[model samples]
Target: MIPALFDRRLIARRRRRAVAAAVPGSDFLVEHVAADLADRLAAVTRRFGTAAAIGGPTDALARTVTASGRAERVIRADVFAAGPAGDHPVDVVIDDERLPFADGSLDLAVSGLALQWVDDLPGALVQIRRALRPDGLFVATFVGGDSLTELRAALLAAESERKGGASPRVAPFVDVRDLGGLMQRAGFALPVTDVDRVTLRYATPFHLMRDLQAMGASNPLRERARGLTPPSLLARAAEIYAETAADPDGRVRASLTLVSLSGWVPHESQQKPLKPGSARTRLADALGAVEHKGE
Candidate 1:
């Protein structure tokens, strides 16, 4: 097993706290992303009989899928237990890495705005692939490497000026370019990956911080600094953010890059790459151009 990069226990605790204290309509980002994933899933040609939604504050994706009639049933799984009966009730609560389903049982698996915090992302992807049946689809979205660049820059500058050094303040995110490789490593066929960048304007850095906390997205790196961030440093960071990232309207911009990844389990019917040196016609012939001979 790989060493844990994140403190999963801490993640679960923070997520539970966020759920308990969450106000109605406070999860607009999560809801929007989940609904988008469901809409994409609905557009696929294949109809899934049994699907699973891996993580969310609530079963938002599951509810969307159920309503669209894309999946006959969707089992919701998360590290935190279900709080109350929402639009979509969770059917199971389990760690993101530990999926409690039989191999090759599910027709589709989807997750949104989660999996970025998992300790072993590659391992988790493998588990999800194993749970999927032949030609089963996997669609997921998570924060990408470019997310929160402005805030990260501000924090680093503040910490450097105030403390003369800095510790890990934000969790490292996966790169979109690497997603296709990860899918191939996990034995998925015809992997596809794309990115959607969403920039949100905030009144101040404090508001951005609060939103992150409410989403349970505060840094969970195992090697993160344990001491409280100095107020002076935070104020300086806020000032820096306003000066550098603020718009004409005076609202600071914070970027969130949502990377969507999708792949299907290997099936004999799926398209395969043609072998090299197998083409009967030359490119020159197709383009109606004469081939040049080298002396």
Candidate 2:
């Protein structure tokens, strides 16, 4: 097996903490992505009778899917054993890497602001694809490579300047360009990927860090530094961030790039690409142009 890149236990603990937090942290991003996913699903001509959302902070996606009336039922699953019960309740708590659904059982699958933390993304995608029936749809959004660019740069610069080196503070995210290929590799047909860049302004880098902690999005990389980050390092990083990333208003900018991926299971009813040299009409004839052959 591939060595784990994220500490799953730590991730689960942080997630539980985020769930219990009094403040609403990072739900805005999750809600935005969930609404976008729901809109995409609404646009589809086909209706899904069953759907599931895997490992998201809120049940927004599941509720949207259910409210669309396209799906008869929707379920939410996460690694954490329990969370705040809401209108859209979680039905299961299983590791996303090991989905419990049976093959060909679902008509749709959606996730919001999740899956990026999974150690084996490709494997998880394959499991999702297998769970979907033929012609079933899959849509998801996760943090992309461009997420937290300012913070990453500031951290690196600060650590290099003070400690003569840097440790992994930000988790590596998937690139949008690579997602389509991953979907195809996982047996998804007509795979598509796009990015939604959301930028927010913060008063200071400390505020940004606080939000990350509240959202349970703090560094959970297996190789992350074991000891407490020196207060001086954080102070220097905040200074660097303010100097380099702050706007004229004196607020620092942070960006989250949500990479949306969509695909469907292949079925006989779905459209297929035409074979080469199978055109019904000649392009020259249609365009009223002469065709010249190679001499």
Output the number of the lDDT-best candidate.
2
Top-TM-score structure, candidate number = 2
lDDT of each: 0.86, 0.87
Ten residues in a row with the worst lDDT in model 2? 81-90
| Per-residue accuracy of model 2 over 1-295 as CA lDDT, tens digit each | 9669999889988888887873655677777887898689778987878888887776778778888888888888877766555422478878877899999999999888779998899999999999999999999989987899999999999999998999999999987888888999999999989888889999999999988887788999999999899999999999999999999999999998989889999999988999999999999999999999899
Alpha-carbon RMSD to native, per candidate: 2.1, 1.8
For all candidates, the clash counts are 0, 0
Collision pairs in model 2: none
lDDT of 1: 0.86
For residues 222-285, write the lDDT of model 1, one tens digit per residue: 9888888779888999999999999999999999899999999999989999999999999999
My TM-score estimates for the predictions, one after another, are: 0.92, 0.95
- On the 0 to 100 scale, the lDDT of residue 238 in model 1 is 98
